[model samples]
Target chain A: MNTLQLDLGERSYPIHIGANLLAQPDLYKKHLKGSLTAVVTNETVAPLYADRVVKTLESLGQKVKLIVLPDGEVFKTWEVLQKIFDGLLECSADRKATLVALGGGVIGDMTGFAAACYMRGIRFIQVPTTLLSQVDSSVGGKTGINHPLGKNMVGAFYQPQAVIADLDTLKTLPPKELAAGLAEVIKHGAIADAEFLTWIENNQNALNACDPKAMEHAVRRSCEIKSQVVAQDEKEGGLRAILNFGHTFGHAIEAGMGYGQWLHGEAVGCGMVLAADLSVRVGLLSEADASRLKKITAALRLPTVPPKLGINRYMELMSVDKKAEGGEVRYILLDGFGRAKIQAVDDALVIQTLQAAGAG
Target chain B: MNTLQLDLGERSYPIHIGANLLAQPDLYKKHLKGSLTAVVTNETVAPLYADRVVKTLESLGQKVKLIVLPDGEVFKTWEVLQKIFDGLLECSADRKATLVALGGGVIGDMTGFAAACYMRGIRFIQVPTTLLSQVDSSVGGKTGINHPLGKNMVGAFYQPQAVIADLDTLKTLPPKELAAGLAEVIKHGAIADAEFLTWIENNQNALNACDPKAMEHAVRRSCEIKSQVVAQDEKEGGLRAILNFGHTFGHAIEAGMGYGQWLHGEAVGCGMVLAADLSVRVGLLSEADASRLKKITAALRLPTVPPKLGINRYMELMSVDKKAEGGEVRYILLDGFGRAKIQAVDDALVIQTLQAAGAG
Candidate 1:
């Protein structure tokens, strides 16, 4: 087991990574300092692991409540958030109550957002059940639900007290979902760590097989990289946007296809390929390097071609994405595998990419 | 104009208190860095001040969008927030869009919450039209909506870029509403400043007459004191909880009777009176001090006693207030007129207060 601490002074917290960390009762009991606990999960993950989490928390004599939301990205709404509030209120959860987000990115984001708004704010933990959540969303403190109009439109930058990423939980995740998560890991490598990218290429199969050590290392490294970035720029004022290496196009794809049609990470994987292709077009990425990127993503069974469904839909959806600043489209472009910068790409580039996706 | 700054680093902004601050076109123009400006106001204030504000902002060559929400606390809900989002999308307002909260607490809170959620937040300025909003809710970054289950159950602590408290708007406010706002001013005196308390006592009647200079001093002093406290505890982590003086019981009075039935300040006025009496019982205040408090509140035409309502209803509403930490029911107890502290008061005290309200 390896652990990394996000040193944000008072808001600083620890992230634990191991295959069986879920069984370590102390991981939750020691860090969770409250009278009541609400473990928020989704319908999909609940049948598999909810009982294990509840039993562990209950053994510590912490009053626990379970709130099971619908299992998809589209279900993240104000109505669903109300169910979380109802669970807390019905259980008499107080301001000191600790919320545990016990599933993947959807569950974690909605639960953390609930904690942020429940009683105006409360303590919460991330018990992420998927690779994408463990590596990316859970640690950054960006919690929100999608507006029918846009994704992550309503939220707060509320940091969690701790993150418990149990790799054992990822054993049940389908290979397609697993491949989707690799998009973020590949993003980490593409934006800042060429060595990590090389390593991921070498160990791609090990991760797909859910090898405990390799999966744990990837989540830990991704968290370490993310924590360092967030500690410096908690609000995406700068540097942190690099974390959105594939997210600009990814959000457009997600919204254009409708939120749940394509899982966030699935869109991101295909979007990364498009962004890399675009980077090459702009003379920042080498064609050879882009091919290597495509080979690795394809090997993992992740999408590598630009999706054709959302070419015209891009303008409307991308307009409201968080990445858009000053009414202009800002893309996180790669200068190389380990260097990325936010750039205002011309409409010609965007149109060409959409055309490429349409023809593909 | 006397200005007070809530110095929250990047989130910090100025609170300008005086007559004609609204007419100063520079106030809106300075923060209008981006191309789009969306002004949110309620129906009541729009016909009077909307054109003037729009004129000023438009003269600066910024694209302007105006959204008028129904004017009342009942309208402060997700439904109204959706309307704001719809308006923003209809006008193609994007991330760089600046949201100007162009009304009182309801408009400001709903607008701020909308801004906080619109593209994960944008620049917002509080144009507080009433005394309650200008002196209190406007300064804090706390923005949210009432839930059927509870008041302010969903929200975000999003700070504004600036707070414009144009006292000129107070001239249009009703006498009863104006008196309701005085409760907050009296609260500022009760919790922190001894001399300010003395000043309010001496000139309470003059303030009732709408003396602009006295109103300026009151608003400026209240903000300065709140600014200092907020700087120390931005999230009600500790000292900031003291700002909720009378709010615990006050929230109950408002929510129990249904919000806006008793104005926020009116409920707080009565809540303060009860708190002072309870403070005497708790040995933190003298009988004379309690009596003096009641006399002053009554002189300002504020309620000295909560409405004779159902006791159980009050209890249920109070439990749902976001301030009840750990289910222990923390209360903001006044040590006297110029100092306050947060303490876990006995449930017996809360029950007694509810019983008293029922019998009043």
Candidate 2:
């Protein structure tokens, strides 16, 4: 078992990664403060792992309640998030009750948000089942439901008690979702570690085949890079903007295409391509490096071509993004192979790139 | 104007108490970080003060958007809170946008919670028009909407950039609302300042008449007491629970009667009476002191009798209160004239107190 700690002072928690860690009651016992525990998972994950987690908690004398939400990104909304609250309230879950989120990114995001708001704040644990969640969403405390206008438009920076990522869960991930998770894994390397990017390039087959050893490295390295960035700027005042390297364009594509049409990671994967192209146009990166990043993105079976959203619509979606300040959409561009920068570029230049990329 | 700083380290903010402070653009100017500002008020307050506030912000070069929600606590639900989000998104309000809560407690709470969740978090200033909000909700940063099951069941402890309490606004308040505000004033004196309690007892006529000087002192003193408690324990881990002095029983009355039937402070006023009775039963407070507190509550024209919601119903409602931990309802009892203690008492003893208070 490998454990990584996200250092957020009092809010800091551990990330446990290994095989069948869900069966280990000790990981949960250390964090839970109350006898009542609510396991919040979606329908897809509940049928698979809810029993294991419920039995483990019940064994420790916890009064367990299973709340199963519908599975999908489209289900991430205020109406659906309220179900978790209803379930908790119906059972008279108090401030001391603990919530264990057992699902992928959608479940983790909604559960973390519910924990942040339920009783004005309570303790929650993240048990991310999908590769995308294990590598990215589960590590950072960013949890919220999406508005119809934008993705992740309403949320909180609430950290979790701990994150348990069992590699065995990845054995069941669909190929598309696996590739979506790789988009974030690739992002960690593309923005922070050149050597890790090269390693990913060298081990394409190993990652594609879902090898345990390769999956472990990808999750660990991605978490290490993310935790370091988050520890410095938990609220994203400045330095943390680099972590949203492809998110500015990715959010635009996701919102423009209507969320759930393209997975977040898939949108981010293609977003990295556009961001790289913009970075080259703005004289921040060489054409060679841009192409290299694109090749690597495509190598992971992720989409590289931009969606067919027109420039005006794309610009409208990007302007409403949370990253935009004072109506100016800030683009996260690659400064080099392993570095990123946040700045606002001219509309003409952005549109030119969008047109060239077939997004116009 | 009198200014008191709530020392919350980096999250610290100033509370300004005086007449006509809301019309002063400089107060708003110093805290606003962006050009776009949203003034969130309710229908009752909009026609009265919305134009003045919008003109103030506009005078300071801010493009103000007015979001008017339905008045009353019954509207303090997720469905109503969504209107604020809709207004912000419609205008493309960004992370840097400032939200000015321009009404009483409900507006302050919903706007503050909206600011806390909008784009993960943003800045907001509290322009409390009601005395209850000016003295209590605006200072502590406890913001949230009510769940169907309970009042304030879901929310966040998000502080505002500044609290602007205009004493002049109190002149327009109805007689019933003025008395409701006095309940919190009396509570501030009872829990933290015996001298203030004595002063309130002696100056009932001035408070009841809405005298500017008396209201100023009451607002300023209450902010001082609440801010000091919040600074020590911002998240209600321990000492902060004492600040909820009468809230446990008060919430029960509010929920049992259905919200909006009794103004929050009115319910709190009556709750204090029952809590004092319980404190006397527990031997923590003298019967003489408890009677004195009840006399002061009644002198302000606030109700001292709790509605007859049988003991079982009261127990059921209080158990689901945000203050309850692991199904144990922790009651905040008066330790003496100027202090409070939090503990779980025997249910039978509590029932006796409720029965004596005409609540059973």
Candidate 3:
């Protein structure tokens, strides 16, 4: 098993990466706090792994409660987040109980947020079952539900006790979901690690085929970059804003497409392409580098062409994004091959990039 | 103007206590961040002081927006919390925008929780109008909405940039509300300040008459005791539990009687009496001291007798309280004149106390 630790002072936690790591009771036992544990998962992933987790916890004499929510990005709302609370309250889950988020990004985000607010905060563990969550959401303490006005507009930056990413769970991921996960993997490389970007470009076929070694490498590299960024700036005051490279435009895309229609990763994939296009138009990134970024996105079967959501609609949606400030949407654009920075671009130029990226 | 600072390390903020504090543009400007500010108040407070706050901000050259929610504790739900987000989104409030929570405890809590979760947290200032909020909720960083199952069950420990407690607003407060605020004032004395308890007893007539000098002293002292306790234990790990001296039973009363049926302070007033009875029964507190506490509560015109919600029902509701652990309801009982601690008492003793307190 490969392990990476996010050194966030008192909030520091570990990420365990390996196949069949879920069956390891020691990993689950070492991190959890208090007496009782609530494993929060979604319907799609619950039937697959919830029982296994419950059995493991119960076998260890840990009082375990389960809350299975409906799957899909659409379910990531305050109403759905309430279900986790209701379940915990019904089961008499106390201050000492730890919540184990046991699904993909949506589950991790919602469960992590629930932990953050439960009794003004409780211990939670991340059992991210998808590559998207394992590399991205699982590492950062950012957890929240989507608002109707924008995606992830309401949430908290609450860390987990630990993160366990069992590669075996990837076996059940559909091809579309796998490709969606690649969007975030591609983002980690595009924003900070050029060598990792090249590795992803070189191992496109293996990654697309879900090769174990390639997947492990990709997840590890992505987590290392995210953990470093988060450790330096946990609250996203400065440097952490760069991690949201494709998120500003991606959130617009997700909101415009009416959430769940376009996967978060898919929106981010297209968003990275548009941000790259904006970077090139603004003369920040070279056309060759921009094309290379788009090339990798396309190679992984992720959407490079953004849906033709009207430019006005896109601008309207993007303006409400978390990244937007004082009526200006700040775009995270690549300054060089592997470096990115937050910049507020001219509206006309942003519109031009939106038009061009949509037409691509 | 009287000022008490809550020294919570980096999260520390100042609580300004005085008459006409809302008119002070500098106090509002000094603490608020960003270019735009959204002032969140309620329908009741809107006509009273919302315009004055807006005028103050506008005169300071700060672009201001307003969102007026329905008043009362019943309105402190996820549905109402969403309206603040809707208003912020409609006006394009960003991460840089400051949310000025301008109302009572309900408004302070919901608005603070909104600011805490808005864009994964943002800067917020508390403009507390009610006595309960000005002395308690406004100072502490406890912000959140309520679930149907519980009060403050869903929330965050996000502190505000500053708190402005304008005593002039109390002029318009109903007599019942003023008495309710004394419950918390009484709690502060019971838990941490013996001299303050005597002061409250001596100044009951002045407090009931809403004497300005007496009110200021009460508010200031309550905040000082609370600030000291919170500074030592922000997350209620140990010392902070004493701050919730009457809250465990108070929350149960509030939940059992139906939210907003009786004021939070009213429930707590009776809850303190019940806790005292339990302390006496457990031999931790003398009957004379318990009766003295009850007499003070009675003299203040606050409820000393609790409604007879079935013992089983009370236990069920109290078990879900944030203070409860492993299905054991930990009661915060006063051990002596000015000391309180969390103790999980025998079920039979708890039931006996409930029966006697309800009968009283």
Report the poorest 10 consecutive residues by lDDT, candidate 3 chain B: B351-360
Better of 2 and 3 by TM-score: 2
Cα displacement (angstroms), candidate 1, residue A332, comes to 1.9
Q: Give the per-residue lDDT digits (tens) of candidate 2, residues A1-360.
A: 999999988888999999999989999999999899999998889889999999999999999999999999999999999999999999999888999999999999999999999988999999999999999999889999998888888999999999999999999999999999999999999898989999999998899899999999999999999999999999999878888888888998988888899999999999999899999999999999999989999999999998898899988888888888877888888888678788999988889788989998
Stretches of candidate 2 off by over 4 Å are none
Give every collision pair in model 1: none
User: How many pairs collide in each candidate, listed in order?
Assistant: 0, 0, 0
Local error of candidate 3 at B131, Å? 1.3
Error of 1 at A337 (Å): 1.7
The CAPRI category of model 2 is high
Listed in order, each prediction's TM-score against the native is 0.95, 0.98, 0.98
Worst 10 residues of 2 chain A by lDDT: A332-341
DockQ of 2: 0.86
Residue ranges of candidate 1 with Cα displaced over 4 Å:
B349-360
User: Each model's interface RMSD (Å)?
Assistant: 2.0, 0.9, 1.2
**Candidates ranked by DockQ, best first?**
2, 3, 1
Tens digit per residue, CA lDDT, model 1, A1-360: 778998888889999888787767899886676778998998899899889999899989888898899998878898888899889988777778999999998898889888888877888999999999999989989998887877887777788989999888888998878888888888888888899999999998898898888897788889888888898988888898889987887888888877888888888887787788778778899989988987887877787665666556676676777777777878888898889988888877877866776622
DockQ of candidate 3 is: 0.82
| Model 1 alpha-carbon miss at residue A10, Å | 2.8
Q: What is the lDDT of residue A302 in candidate 3?
A: 87
Residue B104 lDDT, candidate 1, scale 0-100: 83
